[model samples]
Target: MENVKAVKPELEFTDYTNFEAEPIHPVEGLSQRIIAQIPGSSVATRILQFEPGTNTSPNGIQIHDFWEELYIIEGSIIDLELNEEFKAGAVACRPPGMKHGPWKSPDGCKIFEVRYYSKGQ
Candidate 1:
């Protein structure tokens, strides 16, 4: 068998959570942006977790004028647009100006999303 060694990332990780058990957002909701460039990561990668009854993009989602992708690392999510569903390990990409938020996951969800400003940047 071929063996592979686990290596460290170019970027370190930091926890993103609300100090309170409740969620917080505009209009009074909560979300946790766990990992990000704020922690000096290479890219603007984030571990965003939504609480039950919370919407990741509460007032309508907006994608940057660039490319963005999301991989469901844990739990489940429903894409309101096509009424399609995504589960753990499912990956989705939303291109520039895609209005794709205000979604709900009753049991909560954790997603890994990253943005690259330019090709191979």
Candidate 2:
């Protein structure tokens, strides 16, 4: 498929407790809820919430098999790779296999993220 085919689902806040929070592997202090996805594709989208003082990269930073993009919807987080803090309205994009993160959120935060692999990857 060249593009997403399913009609977009209504965007709304689902109960936080309704979704299981899965740890972002190779990282600590962050969890995510997959909100929408398309079948038979690498595409996956989620909301990631961070716990206060959460930090990743105790061992090292992380990379992914897919392109990754994120928008900070609430609060602030520190990007260890950039050594900078990002707050609400901040956006970031990373190509597949790019080294990034080892994040830290001092006061907790929530971010919306989309991840996907290009066709024939």
Candidate 3:
């Protein structure tokens, strides 16, 4: 332990936890950002929705066989590799070790994603 006799410490307290920043810009076609804070990419997570004609950043997720559930709240998306299409009122699930991601839509789409093993889903 080092000596602390020369200077006295100051005490302070405050409570101010809120967002007061400008909202993100609305892209013409697509965009993405975190909707809430979680532990990590694979653990309990929430992401903002992007519209049709928008493209998401290419993300290669390693789920390690962890299952996942997705709710297409609005719009539609086509998984080029899977040769599958997801539209509004549609639900798609992926089994573990699926090697998923890098999704895109021709017209754009909106989706609500719930991740398991990451968010206790």
Provide TM-scores for the models: 0.64, 0.73, 0.54
Residue 25 lDDT (model 3): 48
Residues 1-121, candidate 2: write the lDDT tens digits.
3365654356686775576789976567778887766665557788898989888767478776788888999999888889999999999898877888777899999998987766765
lDDT of 2: 0.79
- What order do you get sorting by TM-score, best first? 2, 1, 3
Tens-place lDDT per residue, model 1, 60-88, is: 65555555678888887666665766788
Clashing pairs in 2: none
Which parts of model 1 have CA positions greater than 4 angstroms off? Answer: 1-10, 13-24, 27-30, 38-43, 119-121
What is the lDDT ranking, best to worst? 2, 1, 3
> What C-alpha lDDT do the candidate models reach, one value each?
0.58, 0.79, 0.51
Best of the candidates, lDDT? 2
RMSD of 3: 11.7
Model 1's alpha-carbon lDDT is 0.58
